[model samples]
Target: MMQLFRHLRLGMKIGGGFTLILLLTAGVAVIGVRGLTSIGTTVTLTTETNRMAHEALSARAQEKDALLRGEAQTITQTQQHITAIGQQATTTKEKIADPTINEQLGAVVAAAGDYAKVFQQATEVRQQQTAAEEKMAQAAETLVKMAQAIRESQYQLLAEIQEKTQVAIQANRANVDDVSQIIQGIMQLRLTEEQFRLQRDAQTQAQVDSRHAAVVQLARNLQARLQTARNSVGTQVNDGMEDDAGLDIHTLAEQIIDLLETHHAGFTLYATELTEQLQAETEMAKQARLLEEQAERIRADQQQEFAALQQLQHTRPEVRNATLANVQATEQFIRGVLTVRLQEQRFVQGADAQA
Candidate 1:
């Protein structure tokens, strides 16, 4: 093989060498193109992940704001935000090259979903609580009115009893002082009963019971004193007039108390429900925050990946530049070699590598 190569003519050897260099240059170009292509793909993935992650973060923020408003009217808006976040997560997942980032993004999607469900439930419960509170307020107003009516009825009864007792006093003027004092006590007792009606639950139920008992006792005393006076003086105490008023007042008072108690019980129960909803909302908010934080972490990861890709993108150009320089140098060297070969061929006429 050495003897045959040595016997070749100069022109033939030059042609063979040029052909080999050409093939080598072509191979290098192919390799460079393949490397640049891979770099371009990494850059694309990084850019897509960055864009999707930004969108997801924005959507998550909007969802949080909607939840903060705590208004049922915003539920649809909140749902839309969550949906947008989910879509972003899906898109980002596709674009993310790193398995760790992809998995974390999936967790963000799941947490967002959980938050969405609980947030909707909380809003619905809040609406229910609002409605229940309105009803309770209305009932409370009605109870106040009913209690007022009972007070007025009691006043009317006291007036009638006093008037009946006064007739006996004038007829038996000797006992006028004693009867006058009793009438005065009856008026004072009616005033005290008014206090009971006005009393609130700031005091315990026992206090309320005590006041209620006192009112009953005072009413009874007034009725008894009036009856004794009527029996002694033979004064016609129209039994039906006082009986009907007292009975009506008692019945109405009981109803007012019942309503007030019902309102309180309803308030406690509804408030408890509202409290539970609030706690649930708080928990969901925390999960949403965690999801948001995780999305941010993913975004950060994407940014880091993008930085690395940018560096790789820079290296690709450098590699291309280096390859171009090598090709240019090789071309210049080949041209010099061809010029030398031409001179030699002209000077040593008809000489070739084949001998």
Candidate 2:
């Protein structure tokens, strides 16, 4: 080998050796560059995916907050509307001094109060709904974490699968089980949600079946046992049973139940009447508010027309003729004001006229 190498030119040998070294170095460089590029691409893809997930989560949170805030704002607006209606009703009552309007206004105030209570109740329910949504979201997020863990386990399984070793096979089997378990948990959540969707009647039936049946039987047995005890204790005191002396316990209980039921019925009837009156008042309030809004709009339009007319007169030459449009608008504005004022006068005079 030394003799063969010695036969070659010294410069040729050096150049060939250097060229081989350079080719090997270039090959290594290409492989390193490719490895680095692959790593960088993977990192970028993972970062983009994480960013997308974060953005999606943020969007969901924002949507939830927007809904909650929107409802709260709506409730506040409704409250303000109710308060304004109440104040206007009161003022109208005092100014007109109409017994009917006063009565109607009182009914409106009461109805508004009831409506406010219902509104508060509804708001509380919304809060509960929000809480339920949050809980569901948290559950979904937890499940997502489980999915991520499952994915990691799957990767491990795949890596180990290639080794074809016992440990690898066992790990793959465990990963499969883990995946199944996660799927089962997801299914369980779905089932639980489905259960929650059951109707109230069906839920009541289930409760009766599970608990009430046992309770009923127990009560019957208890009553029978108690009767026996009383019979034994009474027998020792007397040889015979009393026909119906002071066994007024049942009768008294029945009478008490009857009294309560009567009271409840009376109260319910009164409440129903109140609700109807309030509903009528609410309608009246709505009508009054609409009329007032219309009147205000008319006034605003008239004011604008008046301002325009004034501006026109000031800007025009003293000898300039009034436009047909200006003359018509001015007449319409005066008629509108008189029409509104007449309506107010008629309402204010109504009680006295009726009397």
Best by TM-score: 1
For each candidate in turn, give its C-alpha RMSD to the true structure in angstroms: 30.7, 39.3
- Note the residue pairs that clash in candidate 2: none
Show where candidate 1 strays beyond 4 Å. Answer: 1-73, 91-109, 166-247, 277-314, 317-355
What tens-digit string does per-residue lDDT give for candidate 1 at 1-355? 3355344433232222222222222222222323333545444433433333333333333433444356544667657655655566677567655555556556546544544554455456556666776776676567556545544544545554565666543433322233344334334433443343233223433453454444444444434554565566453644322346354433453455465456556655564664564454344344433433443443344345334545554656653443344334334433433443344344334322322
lDDT of each: 0.44, 0.38
Query: TM-score of model 2 relative to the true fold?
Result: 0.32
Q: Name model 2 segments beyond 4 Å from true.
A: 1-69, 154-158, 161-174, 184-355
- Assess candidate 1 and give its TM-score to the true structure: 0.47
Model 2, range 302-333, lDDT digits (tens) per residue?
44644554656657523122222323433443
Q: TM-score each candidate.
A: 0.47, 0.32
